[model samples]
Target: MRTVDFSPLFRSAIGFDRIFDLAEAAQRVGEESYPPYNIERLDENRFQISVALAGFRPDEVDLTVEQNVLTLEGRKGDKEGRTFLHHGISTRSFKRQFTLADHVEVRGARSEDGLLVIDLQREIPEAKKPRRITIGGSSQGNLTQIESEAA
Candidate 1:
């Protein structure tokens, strides 16, 4: 297997320092293999992130968004009442975080059939969106006409 260098791809050409932080976080993510997850794009502007949390309850999970980072944490309480003959399943606590873009926001989170699903949507503000400009004449001609009109 070949190792890839992702530093060049994250160069600050877009004037955002957060992208570099995201790249560093992504590198740290490759070291972990516990609790698999899947990310799928539902539509042009919608996305879903699903993680397999076999023994975790809905209340045991926490979802939060802070400083453009989405964090998902799961903690399983201790089973003190009963003892198991064979403790095969692992119920370790875990925390997973994902870096979100500037305008992206979390919609909601729900659990179904041992799977934790998180929904997210990107909403670009009207003023931040790109707008088309109309150009009628050449720059020099327009400048000369404006100057004549002013005189």
Candidate 2:
């Protein structure tokens, strides 16, 4: 596999280190793919992440948002002295991290029917939103009105 150099990107860009970090992570191979999840856009500013956690209970899962990073962790309880002939469900511990955009917040999280649903919403401040600038009539300098000739 070909390797990408990101040194040049850092020399010119500012406050984009997180983006470069994500790209570097994608290039790496043999990363964990357990605990499958999905991200859906409910609306223009609403989103939901659904993670399949069949054997894990609500208490075993933890969700936290800090510094625009959302982390989800699950610690499976030990199965004491139990032997299964055909064990299919996986209850392994897993940790997942998601980087959220500016102004995006974690609304809530709930578990239902073996699925863990996490809701997110982007709330932009009023000062940050775009507003139309009224172009009122203004004269740069002293302007004399010219009399129009009657037709």
Candidate 3:
């Protein structure tokens, strides 16, 4: 059993029930540890996910993102009439998922050196970003009445 520390989120987050839902989903997908992967943060807004697929090809893997969830599925081709002296490398099918924070989006994906690399980014919209409001001088004296000409 892996212990996850959620104290960080508990400290500053409020009204975030989806996070806990994702945690429950992770527990349900436990102990299928194959085709190891890594998640790296390149900067504040950019991230990269690398999955090690030793014997899998680029076309065999599929990636999908929907409603803040990123899913990666790998399908290995069937082995025909070839016999192996020592069975070592595993090309088993796997479905890995990741819960993305708000504003997070999948940028692109590629296969390189037996690894599937996926890029992601968090882009907050202009309307959602914090804005600095300029406090102007009192509006009471700024209001002027328009002098009307004689009809």
Clashes of each: 0, 0, 0
Which candidate order results from sorting by TM-score in descending order?
2, 3, 1
| Cα lDDT of model 3 by residue, 1-151, tens digit | 5667666786577877567666866776747777789999998889999999999887898899989889889898888988999979988899888889889899999888988999998887765665545456865433333343211
The worst-scoring run of ten residues by lDDT in candidate 3 lies at 142-151
lDDT of 2 by residue, 17-126 (tens): 77888788788745777799999999888999999999999989999999999999999988999999998999989999888988999999999989999999998766
Task: List lDDT for all candidates, in order.
Answer: 0.77, 0.85, 0.81
Which candidate, 2 or 3, would have the higher TM-score against the true structure?
A: 2
Which model scores highest in lDDT?
A: 2
Worst 10 residues of 2 by lDDT: 142-151
Please write out the lDDT profile of model 1 over residues 1-151, one tens digit for every residue.
Answer: 3445556765645666566665666666668756789999998678899999998888888889999889888899989897899987777899888878778889998888889989989887665655545566766422112212111
Judging by TM-score against the true structure, name the best candidate. Answer: 2
User: Once model 2 is optimally superposed onto the true structure by TM-score, how far is the C-alpha of residue 102 displaced, in angstroms?
Assistant: 0.8
Question: Where's the lowest-lDDT run of ten residues in candidate 1?
Answer: 142-151
Off by more than 4 A, model 3: 1-14, 22-30, 134-151
- Give stretches of model 2 more than 4 Å off: 1-5, 15-19, 134-151
Q: What is the RMSD of candidate 2?
A: 10.0
